[model samples]
Target: MASNKNQHFVPRCYLKPFTIKGEGAAINVYNLDRRRLITNAPVKNQCSRDYFYGQDDQLEKAIQSLEQWYGSVISEIIEPGYKLQLEHQYTLKIFWLFQYLRTEGACRRSAEMFEDMIEPTGLDSDFSMSIKEAVQTAMRAFAENMEVVSDLKVCLVRNATSVPFLVSDDPAVLTNRWQLEDKRTRGGSLGLRDAGAILLLPLSPTIFCLGYDPDVYRVPSDSGWLTLRNATDVEALNEFQVLNCRANLFVGSLDYAEGLHRFVDEFIHHRPAARHIVNFAIFEGEETAEHKKYRVVSKSDFKDAHDGIMHAQTISQIPSQWPSFLLRRNKSCAYYNGTGIGYLRQMHAAMIETARPFFKVSPYK
Candidate 1:
């Protein structure tokens, strides 16, 4: 019997609206013309090679070492009963036992310190030796920087294409239950918030290596107004930062792997959001090599998202008469300081607008 070609089977996969647990932020890594979401390909030397001193061969060796070690680490950490499998298109995120050391500065230090630690590892190959040294350095750093945060979690994730986000054979990464949905869904997992700092490495276009801090976000135990305020403010700030990275990728044309480091340093790492347009202009207008690499077009184009985040933070800090949900989408007020909704929506809108001119159909797609 010939099956009907026009048979309409209800698709088991469908989009769902859910919060990204802690951060609750969404970014348009979407290419509108292609009608598909764009992901940051984790290539080390794509946009710049400052980390590896501009040597492609060295970067390649480092990546190979990382790939080799990733398996052993997984076997040691993953417990039985956890059904995880290693897949090509998955994302890899590593976590530190200490929270503060998750900072970019500390991560940089870890890499440098690895050079020192490798002396004792006695690994023969340069790649193996380099990684062993880095691991040792990271361990020492973790011990030195240990805090009250939870135990370290080295996670590997199947991409958003899979539902329920669990694999059968790969090493277990996430201990918690994660739901996967369409990337374009309005309220979907555009970004994730973790308590620790992260060293996000893109192993390839599909695979990502994320190194996180030990702490995890949790709801406040106490119901004090100050506690709630602080928590909400943190969440809002995290959301803004995640969106900021997306804007940089899509609008600033920053390389997925290298652009993050530069974006963090310039915008959110140590510096507070510059509220004034002039300050933002100066930040964007500087004739730096990074600006050239990302092709910073208009100073004002970059300033919009910064201003929006600053405004959002300002609004979030004030004693809110309304609930947090209302605050996230409030768009009625015209001014940042005025009594109205939050600035995230406006910020994202501005990001999409800026990305429109640069939006191209993905060559890979």
Candidate 2:
């Protein structure tokens, strides 16, 4: 794929070296829930995007590295056109997928081995080859061509409202693309057509991790989980957009919804010592001589929030979805979930092939 050498999109091959420990099945990295190795999750030797997201410490390290890589790119390397935002809501969505995977079964590590630090040799060559192949396939599946941001340091300013009554911005917009407010709020749309209001906020400039399910709604935890089953339900959601920012959106899963709620629940609402770090201008009307622009003060002043966000504005929720239409429909949609047995089996075979070149113990082989 075409990628700027300066830009640091997480590539699969780059992550393969981290998946395996010392050569051999004894020290292999396996999933706790499935009791199997992730290398065996791909289909017909095809590594899926979920393979990377299914990892725990490794995936976290990838994200942290990507974030840092992006920071350096925007600062010292070539800058792209799109903007990035790192609000609490945005960071959590990216983090929530791995958080769920860690819970579902990403953390079963193999026993420690001194040989882990040694380079692959002899029979271990085949095992190492499998790790490399699986990672390469998965990276190919997840690859995307993202544009370099023009203003690399530009951060999306939220709560640009002219009214003070709507000053309390809901941080839920960080995880779920939409934010549910009292329908009676003054900043955006305020319609009584439904139980409350739904505000499809502006496209977040920053990118976040994709959740398990793409087509799902984050209903109130008390409502026992809700989904827009048909066109009517989808229309209902569309019609409720008071402050319509954009129709295109990426939906979050229950993990995202609940995690966001927990974050809001424990958030320190009042930060007295917080200084005015960023100012967002809210216009009462279109920019004209008579229209008045209100200033909304924010505590966040992130200069490099554009690092890990999607390159496209709103074609899809997941960044990898931008590659091709065919890729978009594939079962491996989200990067932060797991693929089926096919991918794992393919990855496992690759490792076995790697081991065939030289003779080794059965377990290691």
Compute each candidate's TM-score over C-alphas. 0.23, 0.17
Q: 97, model 2: CA deviation in Å?
A: 7.4
Please list the residue runs of candidate 2 whose C-alpha ends up more than 4 Å from where it truly belongs after superposition.
1-64, 67-129, 145-215, 221-365
Give each prediction's root-mean-square deviation over alpha carbons. 21.9, 27.9
How would you encode candidate 2's per-residue C-alpha lDDT over 1-365 as one tens digit per residue? 21222221222322222222311111122222232333422222221233433344544465556544433433321133323334422333332222211211111101011122112122353343233243333333323211111101112222122110010111111112221221222222211111111122222212211221121122221111122223332222222121111111111112233332332233223221211112223333445675454433221311222211111111111111110100111222111112111111111223333322322111101
Worst 10 residues of 1 by lDDT: 8-17
Give all candidates' CA lDDT scores: 0.26, 0.23
lDDT of 1 by residue, 303-322 (tens): 44332111111101111121
Error of 1 at 151 (Å): 3.1
lDDT of 1: 0.26
Worst 10 residues of 2 by lDDT: 163-172
TM-score of 2: 0.17
Which numbered prediction scores highest in lDDT against the true structure?
A: 1
TM-score of 1: 0.23
